[model samples]
Target: MQLNFFPLNFQFTDYQITDVNYSDELLLDLRRRYNTSHSFFRFGENIYLSNSDSDSGIDIATNTTSKNVYGDNQITASLIKHIFFRTFKKRFISYTPVDFYPFRFFSSKEKDDLLFDLLPNQLKGRIGYKKMIEVQLRLATIAGKQQFGFVINIARNWIFEKNCATLNLEGYNLLNVEVLHSEIYPGSCGILAPNEEFIGIISEIINDETAKVLTNEGEQVFPLTELFIRKTKFNIANYLDFALSPDKTSQILNHIESKKQEIYNTKSLHTEICEIAKALFSSKLDGHSIEFMNKDGFYFTVQDKPLEVTNTFDLKTPTFIFDPAGTKTNNNNPDLGLSNFGPYDSISFDIKSPSVLCICHRENRGYFSKFLADLKDGIPSSRYFIKGFQKKYELTEVNFQINELSAFTLAEYIRVMKEWDQEFRPDLAIIEIPNEFRKLKDADNPYYQLKGKLLSYEIPVQYVLTERIKTYNEYILNSICLQLYAKLGGTPWVLPANRSVDREIIIGIGHSWIRKNQFKGADQSKIVGITTFLSSDGQYLLGDKVKDVAFENYFEELLNSLKSSFNRLESEQGWQEGDTVRLIFHIFKPVKNTEFDVISRFVKDITKYRIKFAFVTISKSHPHLLFDPNQPGVNGKGAYIPNRATNVFLDSETCIVQMLGVKDLKTAKQAMSTPIQIKIRTPQGNYNNPELNDMLYYDLAYIVQQIFSFTYLSWRSFLPAELPATMLYSNLISKLLSKMRNVNGWDADRLNYSLKRKKWFL
Candidate 1:
């Protein structure tokens, strides 16, 4: 049959050339669905991919064989399978049945769907990838023998709660399950398990006597008797929002709502947030000089990071983060924590300082191929600034690319890294990606997929952006500092030791809200506060719980909550009963003096123990914006901003801290970052010993330093903390409990006793 290729724009009798890449139309088709520009390229065999950045950039890959792919997050496994069919158009290439996503990644829900045979190339040699990839293996001397167990989501699993599979799972079981068939409580209408995480409209009453419930855990099938219905239909505007259906059970919901209504009484909490605009710079605390650091300096800790006050919290050694699934070898014994290192800070970052780079990337935007093409045996472009870094830090350089997933999902990142660790252990892992991908950390892209999966396990990781590595010469030199920190790891380069009289403990409270089945067809929500107590040295000891109570009352509720928190530290940490203690409470937002009136007429009674209470609110969101546009000694590029650890005290008790950098904000691409406002108020707060000079005893600098130091401690990010440990740990725990509220049961006493020492929240 004779065929003619006509122009795309030309009119045809009935047929149309819809897709330019597949159709061999002579002219272009501009008047398609989207009104956007397009780029067409032809490799061998006229290979073409649609290029439209406005259409959310595309990813394309081609192997020497028939394996090929091109799409914007849409190229499924079936789509890639067609490449073989197209390559061997004259004959059939398939010999066995094929089905599966090309990526090694799978959601917790997709466990049943995946075929074991046609998995990602990285998993071929590994005996079991799922357990390793999905779990982080940590060793502990339970009795005496070293037992290997998974850290689960923290270090090993990148995906954590970030499962993108919209596919329905069978049940909400085992996924953040809190109470497992523990109680049978009476419901408003039907006797129920009030805490059934998934409350959905009965889609179908199956003949199997099961009810279909669409929950946040995805669609689930529950036995019909397991389902609970409100006495009346309370319509929900958004179904995906898994709120307690109106009129399920009010044991949790009604009480919280009643408290909030009684607490607020007014329309809002407060109209005016007192801003201490006039403030003096606090330079010292208790006669000790305070220092500020831009970023966490990779110090020679264990030895370099001299311990001022010896504490039991152990610092982990230098570690790597990457998915080892596709790698040909398994790291049977991944070097985790400081087990083998000598007395000094030996096992920390300076892990045999002639440092090595474990390069592991998904689709590297061809940087991997380009770097290799330029230097067959020498350093790739990704390590362009390596020489400068080496000269700067005096270290050796070796590249070890841990093969795994790219264009990876959260679960995939975690699972692959877990599995890969079985074969390979790295001092530092590199997952080079584009800057755009790093920013889209929304629910869609989930930036934590890369950092969270590795960092939580204390695995040192570096995300080398394609923008930074594409042109080795143009890589930001200042960025080398952190890399040096990672390569030559140890304890953080902290400020000089403070006096032993540093008597202070902080309580961080994170607020998370959940739904409770309410009476009279009311689906109301209650805000719960999760708290963690940190000793003076930023050691997280015990976590406390305050159910749905804000900063109201004679502050008795908060003080009462701290009684157990205080007792635990005293008994476990040897803090005595009569010793004077400085209690600092770190909350999320700014509060008025009304919230800080602890010593006011409202409270006639005080604790027997000597206590000085301070209320400091750390604003995660504030209106304050700061800039060091033309600071001398720093970069003069109009874009340059103050380095991390910048502070501006508005008053003795109020300050603004630039915990992170300008690079972390939305304006990160366009402008410098804004600082967080720290508002403080002390009502009859006095921690001074009679001998100390008031002028030299200035506490603001020390308080500010404490806040800044906690930022670096969060394994959540390599960046300095935006929130302190008390708040950071609290925030994490609150989020975990809130997210898995269906399973999160709260017994304040139980949590302090059981979970205080665990990192289960992370």
Candidate 2:
């Protein structure tokens, strides 16, 4: 058979995860309703709207789109408070137990030095400042996190004016004067009298003529025309007004940025890695005969034939299994749910051993856990929990009230719940992360606490996924497949009990990329070690998974990290004194030159230890698609047509290894994308080590077999994912780090030490 070899020359760089350019869906809807022409919209530097859209687009969070009408008519900080702060009073009074401040705005003083001193001298003389009102606002607690902010009220208006105008009354001990006041409005409140005076900080601006003011007599609403104010220097040192400073927003985004970066780096790194690999065909290496060892001294390998890889595993094949009642219905709408389909023939696997499930959930944590526990061997055929949670138990969306949470959030919660009932303590604690948890912007996020609390339990914690209260459909036989896999410890990915690979030591590496929270408008990134690491024996090492932000931009720091990882792994896993160790790095993206340099330095340093490693990348993101040479196209299951073990050498640098392929299927909509590209790189190749190059094997079938097995061992998902352990590890660790960083802040010292060799993050 003829082989095609492709040359490698790809552009690679530091992949930065940026904010999602969210199209203004609200604006789009508004435009659709009003039938606004596209040409009517004109974007300017400081506006999300055009001149014609006056006062229409006000984003309270940043006030970035706020602007005065023509003639430079602007209001002072005090005036802004009376007019706008009253609209957001409820937010300040009883702050929600959430991290994002969607309603906070920039204070007027921040944008203009004139702190509510907007009245001209002539106007101030007309309405002399005499009465003063002092408002005391008790700070609100955010999910128990104390926060400070202030509001200033100076001018009041009586009408909504296209050219709203106002002359500020003279102030006392404090401020300077700037910005004209216009865009006056008249409503239920009477017009302000030119002679009205002494009505200090307006607590609420009600209509045009009415407003509540905080005087020595306490809060009372008076006619706006009767209100007046003087100069006051309010000590607003630590208030997090959006315009005053970006510190609060920065803090929020910074927590999520790490998480986002970890994801981006993992994907991009995988891409960069696979394309750069060079094939090192070792003539003596056997591709079919596999032999591997486990810690138990047992050996394993592929038997007579490999099992078929289908979209749904055997446990999930419902083609033959049907509803006992043979019920009929309209098109299968998931929203209508599976209830109408009648009694579904239960799909059960031989657990062989009795097992208990511990569902670590949030929100109605205990209730949710109990719900899953009640399901014993069955999944909900209907979407019951989501529809009537509030109705049945008064459960609201946000769970700021920890006591009312009825779920496991803190270690105390776990203890309390378990002690309350023996049923709460299961044999395996599955931290089935709730999807909503990822939307959080703080340290209180449940993902940050999953590890430190659960691993201490007497039983095993086999991490797995369940469908959301809605369908959490990552795969068809999700819950069952995961359950069986957890119980049996063998999948299609596992080799026969009698066979094993020939390698003595196998190393797997994964990468993580995270970014600041995009919603917080802070987008910094870091490559972290909170990634995956595995051995050939399908085992995880604690030290290897000891995650930290990878030192980037500096080769020296990366060098230290490399040394640190190997040292940690060697110490924890008990390295063999003389056995040959194979290091395999699985990256989803390509590598940058600088990153290559770091790897080069690492390889050179490791030579002192005489370790043989292959820095390889396996990517599924490229444009390249592999198909069968004989029969190409769709399969009966709607999966693509490809031979079960098709191997294509696109070039000397790349090979497409089809691990679990099918040729034809008509039962599904889309065919499975089975081919994965593998590329290998050597630090010595860049170093000109001819001897090192000779020792490595470049067999496509061999590597493919290892990768296929790796996919089956994922601790997270039910089915074998497209990703392997090396890349998968980083995804898990980076994700935990990202979430934990939000709650724990930047102090990872605890994580480094307390969880140095613990699988707590899982």
Candidate 3:
């Protein structure tokens, strides 16, 4: 009636064969196995024993199955029924049906085999199964050993990259992509700090020039204090280097490369460059002065006065001197003709009255900042001195702007002077060309293009102290020496200055070469001869080093520098000089590929053409400034009247003459061209209305004789356009008059024709 189940020892022990209903040991063992396999479930209470034939019995059919479907259906139906058993097994069973109760209870061993059918299929039982799952609970327990090991690995890599690699990049928020403070370094005390700009201190041990002395006594020691005091030389070679971490350096390099094309394509930093340049020009040049202001102070001045001249050609401004020989005049007369032109005299204002008023241009700020900082450090004082201009001349303060990209912003600067100095009508104006002009083209212009832009006003301007050089030469010392004399106007003997024949001329050629070289290269000191050029037509050329002797030198330096600096750069990724050249030049050679001769030719053609068509208005009178084709150097030289000659004959009869000393028809015509010629009336020359013949003869002859004396000079060959009407080479009219024959009034071609009166000789 009572059944006890226990674990059975399956291997036979020799004992009487009495089969009990249950053994406690066997039941415990079976129960333990069941709990191990299904620990996720627990029974509510003890369940009643069931007879083998009870309703909870197993269906005996096996290979000959009856009620269930087969395949997936049969498996699924079987699973549903097993699930119910699992549910029912959880509750206590107090009774069973009498039909099943009338039978003996199955032994524990027998029941184990029978209950195998109710057991969950192994594959299905494991599906969708979960045990315990609060993750943090295990982390706090000793059982979570594996998870703790994982977190440590992540921390190590973060620390390594941050400290060892010196990577500038910091951890970022992966979700929002927000930048984190990881870019900053954390201090020892766990304090966060911003990125630092470097304060580098270089310590170098100097090798003593003098050997140390050892005293014979060996006790005496000479302290290092008296050893030697060679100066310490430490310059921040590249300021950007201080803060440049490897990552940051790489980043910047990448950025630069990516933007190379864009940067070169852009004309200027901003449009302000052009606007600033235009703003410097004066609307009117009635008064010739300009104003300038800077942080240092403010000042102004009238432009240089016009040079006085005895002849019309004396009015000529600076230009490439062509005449080999002529009477030289006072050097102070800027227009006095001198073929041996060099940077002999560059006008400089007394420091006290420095023409360079204020440094108002924005681009100048960088220079001023360094200047002011250096001044505090005793740097500027050692390099420069200041003095005042003479008090007699009045000055006008001017202000203006120029864009960074302008080539001829210099004109705008001059124009501004003209407008401001309108009152006294300053004869000379001074201006500061912006440093922006120093920019070398990325790719030099092709077709050797010559380009220039006009200022706001059409005021005439010239270059001062222009220099050019080529890639293969170096002539800096000479240039500095000349610049000193030309600009500072002081002896530069200390700089080892030596004068040579055609030095200026040679330097000028060199200067062009240097400019071309610079356009092609990168050295700064290859510049050569510096000079100015002008024409009688009021074309004033005043670029610094206009005829710079060292231009070739500078050009060469530029080319070399460009090659050295850019040769190694990869071509495909970013900007290079090649790109710049390609953009500007339809055809270009690589920096390393261009030959010196090729560059030189390009520069010559470009410079010549740039100034070739240059129309000038030297005088207000059209006749005085007319082009003379007959002159071999019409465009290059003879455009100006010859020195010492008041009358410049454009043609046999048409001429430009000085106001004073009119002589004959030619002299009279020349006088007509004077801007401020005085009208002279002679007793016989006036009859209420002076006849052209009378004015040309008596009046003109008397005036010339009185003013010019009896000085008869040899006649110079006239310009081609000034060819005489007659083939006679003689200056005498008698020879030409001999051809005329006396005739009767009715048949004479010499009979008075009213048309002769209307047609003046010209």
Best by lDDT: 1
Worst 10 residues of 2 by lDDT: 156-165
User: Residue 6 of candidate 3: its Cα lDDT?
Assistant: 10
lDDT of 2 by residue, 1-762 (tens): 111112211122111111112246644543454322110121322213221213343332222222222112121112222222232332234421111121222222211222223333433223212211112121222123222222111111111111111322211111221111112233212222122223335555555545565544556665544433332211121111222345643553343334333322212222222221111111124534222221212222212111122221111111211233334322322212222231122222222233444444445465544444333323345433222211111112211111222453465445643553554444334445556656766567655554434433433344434344334332323343333333232221222211333233344444444554322223345655433455564544433433344435434544565677667777776766654556555666544554455665565555434455555678775433333333433433422245444555443445556555453222343334436767766453265666556445565445555665666555454335556766665566566556556654344445443244333433
**What TM-score fits each model?**
0.36, 0.41, 0.16
Computed on alpha carbons, the lDDT of every model, listed in order, comes to: 0.38, 0.37, 0.21
lDDT of 3 by residue, 563-601 (tens): 332222223224332221210010111122222332333
Winning candidate number (TM-score)? 2
Candidate 1, residue 209: the lDDT equals 51
Where model 1 places Cα greater than 4 Å from the true spot, the runs are 1-497, 500-502, 515-525, 548-560, 590-608, 631-640, 661-670, 683-698, 742-754
Superior candidate under lDDT, 2 versus 3:
2
Rank candidates, lDDT, best first: 1, 2, 3
RMSD per model, one decimal = 30.0, 25.6, 46.4
Which residue runs of candidate 3 sit more than 4 Å off their true CA positions? 1-508, 511-762
Identify the runs in model 2 with alpha carbons over 4 angstroms from their true place: 1-503, 513-525, 542-558, 561-577, 606-610, 628-640, 659-674, 684-686, 690-697, 744-762
